[model samples]
Target: MNAFQGRVTAALADPTLKTAIDRTTNTARSKRAAAIAAWPEFAQARELGRDMKDHVIANMEYYLTMFEANAVKTGAKIHWARTGQEACEIVVGICKAAKAKSVTRSKSMLGEEIGLPHALEAAGIERVETDLAEHIIQLAGETPSHIIWPALHKTREQVGELFRAHHTDPGELATVEEMVSSARRNLREKFMAADVGISGANFLIADTGAICTVTNEGNAELTTTPPRVHIVTAGIEKLVPSMVEAMTMLRLLVRSATGAELTQYTTFHAGPKQPGDVDGPEEFHIVLVDAGRTTMLAEGLAEMLRCLRCGACMNHCVVYRQIGGHAYGATYPGPMGSVITPSLDGLETSQDLPRACTLNGQCHEVCPVAIPLPTLIRGWRTKAWVQGYEPLHTAWALRIWEFFALRPVLYQLASNLALRIMPLFAKGGWISKMPLAGGWTRYRDMPIPQGGSFLAQYKKRQAAK
Candidate 1:
């Protein structure tokens, strides 16, 4: 299993996030299922969004060039990074040039993907996470459990404990407010002393060369204003043709992610320092990290870039409920992450991800961008076979199955034979011992290959007619 899959397994099996996810999922189902179920609207919407993303991505070079030109015109500098390592190197170099001793960062997954803080730490820079959930996880020296709500694994009392322990002088007090106050006071010092502020952009407007951040706590502003140098890291596909499209994307983002009408703060920054802006970064640098996006784009899978990342899919997935983000072991997790992460990062490491889903299609339903995630997952399966990574036995079995199915006479004959033999194999109307089914039988009772095959039943009905 790759790090992401391993993490996913660990997360699903994790005593904390498991319980938290279980309760959260159950509660969401109880409280919001009616509303979510009403949205038979998701699948169609996702496809439309996917087309828009694909169209832009197919012409990505043009859009990127336009965005860069606008960004430069706005007096900010943009850097191109072919890989995560290169992106970090460029950011670290900027930090070094500014003589930055510390940086206060909002939740930037790309920064984590590149291990920016570790590199900065190596260069003697102190980095502090400014988001409340992130700060909790950071102080615990752990990764985030949930993408939007990082410390979802940590309960209220657990948070209180973390705060009391991390506080400069604390005997361990109680209450969410006190915990919040302590965290705020502690982070205030880091924010005040930091020389650099770093973040991730939700969308980079190609028309205006502007980047936008949406947050609940108003921390996005603080993250940029406290430091003389503000830097943003973004995946190259984060670009859109104009702020108009960006606005449309944002409208869908908040609603799809948390079911919110709007975020607390939706701030846009164009370039860097301004002539009369009293409080803003003196320099702004946007690092567009290609990593494996270009490869994905080239391979005709660029539709994944249409994601506005509202995270509604994660919120509603059965697997993500049973498991959590940490188990996926990638910067991105949940339904969209299953395909995108492995595609960007590689399946050799993320082989388990495609198998991790139940193929129930909740992800595709919730996806605002309409990326057919399950179909994308099936594509990954084909890619794995093409790479010679899949077992030959499984590949041969697939071919045999496909051949029979394509030949209707042979498939029906085989189905009739299996239906005839199925009853003999069944014990108590269930098959506990079956080939390639150990994983299935581990938790579920496999219904005896029932009522003959669907083809057999359908044929019998046709004959009756």
Candidate 2:
């Protein structure tokens, strides 16, 4: 194994990441009732967002074209980046143009997708994450495990301890409020002093060129204001056809993802600080990043773009429950991550990812937009197999299968012979070690041909009928 495999192994070994994944999945599972019980608003929001997402995905090309026009008309400079590296360059150039010394951001996963903070730091500007959870993950030098609540993995006690260790001026660790206050005090200093502010849009409305931001704390407000220049980084798929679509998305977005009637704050900023505005940025920039979306749109993977980042899929995912985000080595993790990341990043960088699942269907059931995750992963598996990414033994097994499958009489004879001999090798109706199947033995048991082959069983049933 190379450094990549070594990194994969190390991330898989990290118990903290696994704990976080479990905490998230468990919370998601238990919160389903609470989320639905507190229905009406949240349910409406989820359905609204889901419908809006589906609508927009169906007409993505039209909406993107419309959004770009409106965004330009609103006096916001628009930069189209086709790749992650291009997005970083676009953002860095904007910061540099404003002569920025430091930048503050409000928890945009797309920023992490493009490694914006690293690029900003590399360009000699300090970029600080202002969201409480994101701030924790950033300070810890880790990628976000959970999407909506980035630091959901860490308990209040853990945060207090982390603050106790890292915060320069702090009080005794007691309540979550105190820890939040400590974070607030520290982040406030950065917000007030920063030259530029960057945020991710929950929804981008084409009708009015609005960037809709939803948040619990007032940090988003401060992060967007108090800076000379502001920028919004978002995937192109985030566009909405109209304000109605945005409102619908917001309705479903809050309820399904975090079970909030309404997020603590929801704001739609149309453009730069208007006249008579007491405090807002003077310059506004929006960078539209495609990364691999354009290509994916043309492929069978387009539906992956329908995701609203609700984090609902990971909540129901078993594979994500066991291993977690860091194990995948991508910005987006869990169910959506499994599909979108590998499609965008390709197999060489993410060969182990699509194989990480057990073909579970929970992700699809809970998805707000109904992405067929298992089918997508299987498609990627087939694609990988064609490219020889699969083990040679697996390839040879497939070849043997094809060989037998092409000859029906020969297959039936071989099948009958195996059925006769299978009982001798079987223990409790399962074969522990199979002759030509390392795949079956690696992680699970293979059931023996208990009664007979499917053909034989079907023939017997037919005869009985």
Candidate 3:
């Protein structure tokens, strides 16, 4: 097995990880259902959200240009990056120009996508993650396993232990609250002393040039408000035409993300602090990263762009709950990740992702923006097959199976022969061992063939009747 498959096997065997995933995702799914059911107009709202996103994607250039112009008008510099490397360079250059030694950051998936934390570290700048979950993972030297809840895979005991090792005065932090307090105390200094603050925007308004972020812990507000220089890194697809349009999306976002009516803090930072503003950054920069998004749009995979990043798809994904996000081995994980990863990283490297799904359509059912995730995953599989990305042995096996499958008489003869030989491996009507099928039998027993094939048995039954 390859590295990805090996990781998946390892994850499945980790009971603690599986338990964490099941509990957290089940709660999220239940809460989301309750919240959506409470809203009578949710269906209409979802349809409207889909339509709005489709419109923006269709006229992406116009909205993007408008946003840049308005953002520049508010004294915020707009930087465009066609790739992750360019985005990282732009951000690092901004920090270098500001002579920044440290940066306080909120939770930004786009940052994770471009490996921004590593990039900042390489430039000899201290990166402090302000979000609680993100800080926990950062202290543990681990990547986020979930989009909204970065430390979902970690238990409270695990977090307490991690804090005990990393935080000052480990003796003082015995409880969850104490650990949180210790983290806040440590991060408060970082927030004030940092030369630059980096954040991610959930949506960017084209008309008013505002960068909006919704957070439950309010860390994003501090991340954007403090420091001399502030940088917002976001995917190019996160654009809305107006505040009104954004509000509709936000309604769907909060409900789908945390199953709350709204997050605690829904902040809008419009082009840094104004002249009279008492508490705000001195400079603001927005780095829009394409990084294969445009390629996805060009290749008719634009539907994936409608994703709000709410993560509802994964919450309801059977495979995700079984093995968790780390098993996927990608920046993004679960159902949505299965589709997007291949699009961004290419099918050759991420081929296993598409095939990871059970294609139960639960992901599509739970998706707030109504993206057909299962269909898109299937599209990637088709692309893989057409491009000959499948393994040589598997490909040859399928071809041989198909040849017999297309011929009824030959297929029946083959099945009869297989049934006659089945007793060699069958034990108590279960095939515990099978040649060339160890992958399946290794996990669970396959039932032995009882009597003749179903087609042949059906003919015998008809004759009997």
Candidate 4:
């Protein structure tokens, strides 16, 4: 087994983790199916969403320039980053210029991708996560396991214990609501005292120069509004031409992400606090990150740019459901991650990610933008094979199989010989163990051969007829 498969085997041994993943994924899958089924025009809407994103990607340079111009006009400073280190440096520079002592953040996967928290802490700036799930993992010194629901792998009991250990009081908070209230009380102080706030944008409007964020807890609003310095970090692909296109994408995003028509709050910020505005930031900054996106665009993997950061693909993925997200061991996880991680991190480092999937195509079926995830994964597999990255045993086995497959007489002779000799190893119509097939038979029995070759069966049937 490869390293990725080894991790998956280890994950499968944890029954508690399996139960948590199964319950969460099953619930999310049911809700998303029901939500999509309720809308008669969802199919057309999905196609339209895909088309809009494709257009933006094709004309990415033009839209990015237009966005920068409009944002400058609205008095927002824009910064472009070509690498993760550059992105982190830009953020730290802004904080340092503002003399920020404490920074509060809303959940941004871009922030995670660039390792912003470590950068901030290394600079002696306090970094606080305001989102509930993010806050939980942050306190636990762990990374997000899923995109939308970062802590889905943790049970309520686990969260309660985490809160008890982290919170000041050891009070008996027996229910989820009490635990949430405890976390809120602790995070509220951080929000009020924050000197700088960082957030991720769901959609960036090129025409209006708006940065849009969607959240259930309203923490993103607080993160953007209360602090004196507000910074938005987002992938370059988040840009849309207008509010209409943004709205259409939002419709698909919320439904695919959480099975909701809309999140509790969807806030849009065009610039810093206006002259008449009561509560808003004094300075606004938008950072466009292009760590590996330009490379992806040049390659044929630009189809992945259509993703809305919705978790539906992972929610419905059989491999993700079985092994959970942590086994992938990358920033993103599941089917979409399998395709994009290899492109961003290179096929050499992330080769196991593509092999983690079953290529069952369920991810393609449920994708809000209809990205061909399975086909992209197969492309990676082909790339790996062509580059001679295939395991030695697998390569030899395929060569042997191909040699016999090309010669029908030898194939039939070998098959008949196997059929006659296999009974020596059969017990109760099953093979309990085998030398070369331990991977398959280790956990379960493999069924013994039941009849002669398919060609023999066909010939006998023809003669009887």
- lDDT at 465 for candidate 2? 100
Indicate the worst ten consecutive residues by lDDT in candidate 1.
Answer: 28-37
Superposition error at 465 for model 2 (Å): 8.7
Using Cα atoms with residue i matched to residue i, what is each candidate's TM-score against the true structure?
0.86, 0.84, 0.90, 0.92
**Residues 1-465 of candidate 2: C-alpha lDDT, one tens digit per residue:** 654456556655665756755766676667764766766565445556666676777888788888888887777878889998999998899999999999999988888888888999899998888998888877778778778777766766678888888887869869878888888888878989999999998888888888888888877888989999989998988888887777666665676687665788999877787888888999888998988887888777867878888888877777666555666678888778878887778776676677777886878776766678889988888888888898676689889989999999999999999888766767777777777565456445677666778998999999999
State the displacement of the C-alpha of residue 141, model 1, in Å, after optimal TM-score superposition: 2.0
Winning model by TM-score:
4
Clashing pairs in 1: 4-328, 4-329, 7-326, 7-327, 8-327, 8-328, 46-370, 47-370, 257-310
Ranking by TM-score: 4, 3, 1, 2
Collision count for each candidate, in order: 9, 3, 0, 0
Better of 1 and 2 by lDDT: 2
lDDT of 3 by residue, 1-465 (tens): 987889889987786887778768889999999999999999999999999999999999999999999999999999999999999999999999999999999999999999899999999999999999999999999999989887889877888889888887656666878888888887887888889999999999999998899999888878878799999999999999999998999999999999999899998888878888899989999999999899999877899999899989889988888778888889999999999999888889999999998999999987888999999999998999999999888699899999999999999999999988877898887899899778778767888777898889999999999
* Alpha-carbon local distance difference test for all models: 0.78, 0.80, 0.90, 0.90
lDDT of 4: 0.90
Clashes of 3: 0
Write down the TM-score for model 4.
Answer: 0.92
What clash count does candidate 2 reach?
3
